[model samples]
Target: MSLFSLENKTAVVTGGASGIGEAISKAFAGQGAHVHILEFNAENGERVVGEIKAKGGKAKFHACDVSNNVQVTEIISAIGTQSYINILVNNAGIAHVGNLEGTAEEDMDRIYNVNIKGVYNCMHAVISKMKEKGGVILNMASIASSVGISDRFAYSMSKGAVLTMTYSVAKDYLDNGIRCNSISPARIHTPFVDGFIKKNYPGKEEEMFEKLSKSQPIGRMGKPEEVANLAVYLCSDEASFITGTDFPIDGGYIKLNG
Candidate 1:
């Protein structure tokens, strides 16, 4: 049997419309998992679902904002009736940039709503079902959670919560056969990066972009698929022996940096 094969598994990938989430969804589908994309963006969500179906993959889209507890609970419950979910990729997140001085109450709350509470809401909603089948949970984290990054106070706090949640869940489900892990990447080349650059440094976008790329010791941004590959391994039974750990897909950012 193929070690990494996810055949017949059901997966829910939050934020599955683009960037890292999209890559994870595609990778799961490629490995024969029936994936459901939980996203708030209807346009992107539909586009991703249609593309997967076009490729003869099994998937569906549910319009959900992970931060919304009622919506998340309803959607996951409905999905449970159709198929038992075996893998969950908590990739749904929002970005915020501000130091402690600049971080406002509203900014922190907004970040918490989507980044931290969003994970809490979704996991709480589906954890009972996950426990039934001995499932896998991979939460998308960031180097920001481990190391200090400039102007990312609220963002760092949220990711820190993600790492801890992974640990707690892993420990809680150890005897029950559920495995939980997290991946912390430094800075992947995603649309969010571009959007940040455009919004923050419009005139000096190229210069700022280059600075961001070179910040990593690898001298470039990590790719979405690079993170996806690691996610694939963790979600597979091949990694059955692993749990309660934070795997860093960072481009030598946390360990090798000066």
Candidate 2:
């Protein structure tokens, strides 16, 4: 048997429209899983599903806002009717750049709603169904989850919650055969990064991009596919013995940097 083959499995990937989430969606589909992408961007979501189908993979797109509990539950419940969800990748999140003093109360609230509550809503919506059959849950965390970073107070706060939630769910569902884990990645080279640099740095975009990439000890930003590869392994039955762990795909940013 192929080590990471996902044949006959069904996967639900939140925020599977772009970047790391998109990479994961494609990787899972390539491995023979039926992927259901829950995303807020209708265009990108539909595009991803269409591309997957064109490649002879099964994929469906659900227009969803993960921060909305009612919407998340309703969508997930609808998906449950189709198949037993075997893998869930919670990759939906927003980023904020600010220290405590710089962060507005509204900013904190917005981050909390999507980053923390979104994870809770998705997990809560699926846990009961997952309990009936063994499954894997992977939450996309950040290096900020464990270590302090400059000007990311709100983002850090939400990710810290994510790491703990991962631990809690893994412990709570151990007997039920649900494996929960998190992936903490540092700066990843994505279109979002490029857009951010272009919008903020303008003529200095390349300089800022290089600076951001060099922040990691590995000397360059990690690739989305690199993170997706680890995700695939974790979600596979080959990793059945693993649970309640946070795998850092941070390009040595968490430890070696210091």
Candidate 3:
């Protein structure tokens, strides 16, 4: 058998419409898994599914808000009724840029709702189906989960909770054959980054983009596809021996940056 082949498996990917989540959705479908994309952006979600289908891959788009427990549970239940959910990628999270003093109550609450509670909601919805058969859970965490980053208080707090949740779920469901893990990426070059730079830096977008890229020890920002490659391996059967680990695809920022 080909290594990391997900033939006949089913994967549910949150935020699968864009960036790293989009990359993971495509990669999973390319590997023969039937991909269920749960995205708030129906337009992008349908576009992705169409692209996958055009390439002869299996995929379906479901409009969903991961922060809502009832919505998430209902969608997962509908999907589960068709087949066992062999994988779940909790990649639907929003970022906040602010220090403690700069972060208002609503800022913290918004970050908490999407980043922390969203993960909980998706996992909670899918856990029972995973319990029926061995499965994989990959949460998108960040370098902030382990190290300090300026102006990221609320984002950091939510990611820290995600890291611990990975550990807890991995431990709690080991006997049931559920493997849980997280990926901590540093300065991924996504459209969101470009928008952030355009909005904040205005005329100096190039200068600010270069500065952000160079923050990684490797001297560049990471790619969404690179992170997706790692996600594929971790969720594949070849990685059955691994569980509860945090993989840093951070361009050496996690260790060499000091």
Residue 234 lDDT in candidate 1 = 97
> Which ten residues in a row are the worst by lDDT in model 2?
249-258
Q: Each candidate's TM vs. the true structure? A: 0.98, 0.99, 0.99
Residue 152 lDDT in candidate 1: 91
- Residue range with the least summed lDDT across 10 consecutive positions in model 3: 125-134
Report clash pairs, candidate 3.
none
- Steric clash pairs (candidate 1): none
Q: Residue-wise lDDT of candidate 1 within 1-258, one digit each (tens)?
A: 686999999999999989999999998998999999999899999998889889989889999999999999999999999999899899999988789999999999999999999999989988998888689989999999999999999999999999999999999999879999999998899998999899989899999999999988999999999998999999998999999999998889888998
**By TM-score, is 1 or 3 better?**
3
Backbone clash count for every predicted candidate, in the order shown: 0, 0, 0
Report lDDT (Cα) of residue 146, candidate 3. 99
Kindly list the per-residue Cα lDDT of model 3 for residues 1-258, writing each as its tens digit: 799999999999999989999999999999999999999999999999999999999999999999899999999999999999999999999999999999999999999999999999999999987998779999999999999999999999999999999999999999999999999999999988999999999999999989998988899999999999999999999999999999989999978988
Q: How many backbone clashes does candidate 2 have?
A: 0
